[model samples]
Target chain A: MSEPIAGAPNGEPLSSDRPPAPSPEEAIRPDGRWLAQVEAASGVKAGACYGCKKCSNGCPLSFAMDLHPYQVVRYLQLGQMDKLEGSSTVWICASCQTCLTRCPNQVDLPRLMDWLKEELVRRGQAAPEEKVRLFHQLFLKGVAKRGRVFEGELMAGYMLKTGGAFGPEAIKNARLGLTMLKKGRMKLLPERNKDRRWLKALFREPKGGSHA
Target chain B: MPEVSYYPGCSLEATAKDYAESVEGVCEALDIELRELPDWNCCGASAAHSLDHRAALNLGARNLALAAQGPSPLVVPCALCYNRLASARHELLEGDDLVIDEIKALGGGYAGVEVVELNDYLSSPEVTALAKQRATDLDLSGLKAVCYYGCQGQRPPAVTGKADYENPQGLDRLLGALGVTVMDWPFKTDCCGASHSVPRPDLVFTLVAKLYKRALDQGANCIVTGCQMCQANLDMYQEEIAKQMGKQVYLPVLYFTEVMGLALGIDETPKWLKRHLVSPKGLLEKAQLPRQTWERL
Candidate 1:
């Protein structure tokens, strides 16, 4: 990951003089190119946001987010990638699409969040919220290897990565795991696809092709 | 008399075994012939879309391709699986042409293969008639339950295409048809902190607490949901929720099919109902819902 630059959350610095950065509302400066880039990447019209806070209001996790859904759009409207990178809103998004359903402008905030996540990972920047990102990676990796997700395998892998293994949390989770097992809810073995080659190939980016 | 193609997804085989069993029982009673999708893979839902959009689409697309080879409306039971499969098809028809071309090449182009959620399939008029006829023998009107539709069932209309995304009535009407007194609750279509059931149990605990509180407030005896992940979270975490609430609270979270299976007078009611972490037997017994066969317990 790149070293944190002065006055920048992830890397890009604010244009104005630094100390006591203005609130996002006052910091809005139109960058047409950023708007275009965001629209291109997310396939969402960032320009159409119109500052409606419906997405923010309906979001279940907005309280935990550093920037609410509307604010994320505001950052995209101003092409403020640095602000988004620094904010936990994108990384913390559950991708529930509650925002997408409520948007009057049909702005797909979930898709936008997905695009932002991809951007952050591409830059090798540390995610604002670590566990969620790690979980998403492990989830995909598990699917890529096996045709399906074995809860036992996924849980073990997640606990190991997040330091839950041998931790107090692991014990608590183990109790629940045992309960599920007794109920015959968890399978000890994973089911694999007959030919995983095609499935594996899907994860790789095609030559000269853009993912989003 | 159409034979629907069934996609159980990964969860149905393991964590959602009861859901699978109950669904089969309900399907059989309703005379809805289900042909399991041969060697179906994961939908990559609740994870893949958030990570690799292309891979997620391809994963869902591959299943669509496989199902297209058959003649049936692809019936998906898991809400997340329904979302992924339907979303991929939606995106392919609506997304960028270049990406659509790539998906077609990778997963093979699928034409006229309609992906349907199991809830909608069961709730359709003809099936409802069959269900009502089949359920004539079983008594369930005494049971008051709240229906939870958690995210994938109704969000991002492009994918789910549910008529009433904000307030889904399919499960309600289906359960109601079987004489279940479906409660009028506000949190019906709310999210249940899905995958957060793991990794971040704290959030899930809080989220699920709200659901439990709401159901109790409405005097619901049990909670019925269509999604397996929702069922797991609500059903498995009651003990934790009780601790969090500082009171003894018991709410049996059941799949819609389980309730339907009970009302349909299926062969094995105990098989599926007994599998829940929170047993619904007490609730079932109290409600006076018929247990024609498995009363020996």
Candidate 2:
């Protein structure tokens, strides 16, 4: 495996302004076990990426990412779990499928990012962008309860969980929420799905459930 | 009447209710019967797939299983829901026995049912012809639109099977048939930072601002789309985007179905238009389209 100059947390330069020199001790070494796990979980071979930066070039959210999309694939190829798990890229990726669409190898980077997020939660690691992960969790929790999303409830839960119930952002959202409510765009009541039993069973943890 | 199963997804019921009403009106006028899928659950969208691959598949499969019982093609209006359901179908068709078994265990049968995006379904020759016939008296000549087909509908060509995912022309063709000058622009299939609007409004504002500015640059009066999320993001955030850009960027972002309904002279067209955060009423008035006086309910 080629050594990446390890200065930034993900072994990529912190920014274009500062380029770090290579250090042998800090270089990421390829570990096949993690790579195998990612491939097994995502069903996409990250090793197939030929260092083309097409994924990075096309990603809409790459500008906000610590590591570009191609760099994430490179980390996977090197089995750099710390870099992959630590990335804001995984959280920031909107699953827009831009990278996967332009990828010559059909690398499925978005799917890989999804696996990394699940693995991060599985390992009990806090996502770099805590709110992004929180939003997904709250969204799923609503789905589990009602079998459908209650946007009004979801937003309230999110605000409370993030401790931003009366914060500036929350205030902005609350105003928008009021407008939506007035316009009849927001439902005051949550709609219930008929088969709540099936939904409960589906949300229940493993063993014969859908999660397994 | 040609009948097909419909999946409105969760957004259509609330935030994009306008899209739902417009879709019904347009379909009714076109003589198409939309049989809403029975007891449909959420497709889990990006959240399900992002958190648990199996759960996402199961959620989508459950809906597909229900749709499979009635129709060959399940038409989904929300692009996010469409992507999740179609991705689940793709995985099921890939012959993953584990996934298939889990879906079967969840009482979801895999019958290889087709999941069609609503825009592609509406763009069919028959539907477009019907729309043209219904729109004979409508004058949309003053409306110039840039059809913004946000990412979910046509990306990752492998899953969507859209050969022209990069330069999809379905909305352009449909709008053109309605006599609206569909401006050809490059940002049609771009991402509008969907769902991130909640967690990261800054990102959505930036992306949406770019889309709005590009629409203006292309000489389009408005932006047209099919997905509810796209419409919501593009429509609801224009004020925020304008504030951030420090410019007057008030472009009317519309759902294609609403436009279709307007062309068909559907009575509920004014009601649907009233629901928009950025109203298209002024644009319609400028186009000399007959305006029905509507009092806010």
Candidate 3:
């Protein structure tokens, strides 16, 4: 269930059916109310963070992200949804868990990042990074349909959807495609698992339809 | 001789078919029967989780439920799949009410099945001992390999249960048992930018370039890895990476299974080796191990 109200950067409605955000005064109350919600969702102790930046220091993609691992958590603690949701950090996380595994506080940055991405996708907001988002959409669409990914169909769909179907981009990929074909890596057929309908119903329609 | 329920994941059926074939070949040689998980679906990998957390958990939960029918370790060959499956089990066990509710609703319950990655499953003492015995007549002493653990195998020790995530010893031990030299390199546990290869090949080129350079700097003949994402990215992007650097960077990235299969003296080794982007024929030849048709063709 989703509401038609718009607050996301792309003016898309927030995807979840959760209640409206509390007033600024209620949110910043010193009782740590906002922190509790984050801690509950992420299964991490938000206040336990000493701002040591250990997670940031150890994250492999920190250089590429807008906000480092610790900063995302810090923003979450402060109830800064604007910074948390708008930053490219969430999409760039890669879910590698380097920060989670190496964090002194054992904060689950990867899972938290997943929650953020889920929210972004639900709200139909275009991710700051385009291709990664499109790839995820196409991949899940393939899985939702066939229970598993068909590399040939998936790549072709991706190239077509991205408008690179028959141009320099396709030419560049053709070399790799030929190599894969020769090596038998790219199968021409899609294999359907026995219970395809079950997974198809699960992911539902791809919302935002490849970037609205 | 224990049999395990195997979930080959999507890559193994497609891009990483050699990995699946070699894994089965090696397992057969080790006398470990891999019964395919009946009608298994994709493990949701990074996409499902990114799109919706509950859906991702449910996807993995369904696979675990199928594997639960039999009392065997669930062996997943793809690192991404293994991570997703293991993470789902961990969350279910940790009492994620939503995940547990979804599992129950789907007629799937966690049966305490052990989800193991290929590296962990093959590197167990018994399996390694069996491998050593099987390969007693074969020697790979000349093959200097730097084992790449990549991101999935070592992260969030909670899910991976890897005590030393940074410098995992499983791959090295398995390779060493085959008489191959495991080079000590610094980038063993680094991320190959994971799925970024599909979206941002430019970033992947830089990340892989660093990895290849490290292996090459150590005078390694090739880079061996257990994770599908790591192998695919490094192998698939070698030519592009080499051209970007304007040099002849011909490092053959081999799945550890191929190496193990070779040590076990499997004849299908050449067929598997030929599947690689940057050919490992030269290295296999230089190692003085018995050459397969890969060297000739």
Q: Which candidate leads in lDDT?
A: 2
iRMSD of prediction 2:
1.6
> Residue-wise lDDT of candidate 1 within B1-297, one digit each (tens)?
678889999999999999999988888776678999887889987678876777777787778888887767999999889988888888767643434443465455554579888888888888887888877566677678999988887888867777789888888898888889989899988888888767677778888898898899999989988999999889887897889888778898988888877776676868887778888877877888556533632
Sort the predicted structures by TM-score, highest score first.
Answer: 2, 1, 3
For model 1, the DockQ equals: 0.46
Candidate 2 lDDT, B1-297, residue by residue in tens? 888999999998899999998998888888889999888999998898889777788788888888888766899999999999889888888764545443476455554788999999999888888888878577787889999999999978888999999999988998999899899999988999999988888888888888888899999888899988998988887887898898887678888998897788787888888888997877777767765723331
Clashes of each: 0, 0, 0
Model 3, B122-200: lDDT tens digits are 9988888888888847778888899998888777887877788878888899899888988998888898888888777
Off by over 4 Å in 2: A1-20, A206-212, B96-111, B293-297
Candidate 2 vs candidate 3: the TM-score winner is: 2
Candidates' interface RMSDs, in order?
Answer: 2.0, 1.6, 1.9
Could you tell me the lDDT of residue A102 within candidate 2?
A: 91
TM-score of chain B of 3: 0.95
Give the clashing pairs for model 2.
none
Q: What is the C-alpha lDDT of each candidate?
A: 0.81, 0.85, 0.81
| DockQ by candidate, in order | 0.46, 0.57, 0.45
Chain B TM (all candidates): 0.93, 0.95, 0.95
lDDT at residue A129 of model 3 (Cα atoms)? 85
Full ranking by DockQ: 2, 1, 3
True contacts kept of 2: 0.72
Candidate 1 Cα deviation (angstroms), residue B46: 2.1
